[model samples]
Target: MLAEERLAVILETVQQKRSVKVSELCNLLNASVSTVRRDISTLAEMGKLTKVHGGAIALSENFAAVEKDMEEKAHLFLKEKQAVAQYAASLLEDGDFVFLDAGTTTENMIGFLPKKDICFVTNGLFHAKKLAQRGFRVYIPGGEIKCSTEAIVGAECACTVARYHFTKSFLGTNGVSVSAGFSTHDVNEAQIKSAAIENSIQAFLLTDHSKFDQITSVTFAQLSQAQIITDRLPDAKYRSFTTVKEVL
Candidate 1:
């Protein structure tokens, strides 16, 4: 096939799958690995896709710009997210004011919280609704809600978060690197997370192991500001930068 035709096919495959592996693309295109690699590289350079190890994912997969369906995110890391949420919930004390950031893993903690009189604030609409239904004092920051992530963010949300102080906060991120610290794909969400960290006395990051090596658009907080709660310990590369607590 001509280079132009091959590139068109590759782009179509990426759009359909949201991500594509080099080997898979090679098989589908009936082309040599080198040719497929070149196409991927060219497309990546043109800002059509992001090349990850062993594969290339559509650049739009990162955040709001892409349609990240909520049902798909809810199914990812199901068991691991639940375990991390339970572990985080165990750390909560009665009557403690808590801030919960928006993410599937952190949202899981809502199911495990005690049914008592405690102040709960969140930037996640789902979380706020769950907590309110449970009869807990829940506050949802005022802002525009991004449909893709169900996260409320913007200047209004940041201003609301600044007015309250929490005893502890639980946050989640799209990426967690030793050097990059906690990061997310959206700048507005990152700003909200930063505000949460500053307003809370103690902060804990709840994320799955998959986030450890990735890098996202905006860095929200440093490693020192929060302890990480995950199912497995991080590799040696991250050991020097932060403390990771492995939850069984």
Candidate 2:
């Protein structure tokens, strides 16, 4: 294929999939590795895509700044969230002190939680109720509830989270980027999530493939601060910073 045609195909694939490996692009373009790499570089220079280690990612788009309602978010990527949540829930053991972040994926985890002697500390009103109803000991921090996302967030929440060191923490993020790290749209929510991760022995981020390469307003932690459990990892370079468990 001509260079222009090859570049067009490469851009389209990255835009559609959010990321694409150079080898995969080569096969799609019927071009050699060098040709593909050169085309990628050209596109990268044109600011059409981001060139990473062995692949390219789509240019980051501005996702909605306002948080979605819990019901709206619950239906998106439901299968993927279930997979990631189930895997996260399985990691729990008896006598573990867990910090479960306020999000749909973390909420999904409550159903799959093993009937272990696990204690959960959460800032999610619904999460606390669910965990309690499921016969697990659960605690909720004192804070103002953010109605849009149904998350308890404020200085009080962050302060309470800082006082307790957890055995494990399962967090959710609006975006995950190599540069900006794990981010969310709300500063209050970010503060609480940061406090939880900082006071935990091990922190895990429960995210799906769509979050990769995206960035949000506030960064709670760096890429090295937490391991990731996702349904799919769109880029291999994320592995360079921390462990990523792709359940799919």
The candidate that wins on TM-score is 2
Model 1 pairs in collision = none
**Residues 1-248 of candidate 1: C-alpha lDDT, one tens digit per residue:** 89999999999888877667899998998999888998999999999987765667676444222334567878998998999999998888877999999888888998898665689899888888888888888888899899888999999999899889999999998777654578787889988999999999999999888777665667799888888999886565566766778876
Candidate 1 accuracy as lDDT: 0.83
Worst 10 residues of 2 by lDDT: 59-68
TM-score of 1: 0.72
What root-mean-square deviation over C-alphas does model 1 reach?
9.7
Q: What local lDDT score does residue 152 receive in model 1, on the 0 to 100 scale?
A: 96
Clash list (residue pairs), candidate 2? none
Off by over 4 Å in 2: 1-64
**How many collisions per candidate?**
0, 0
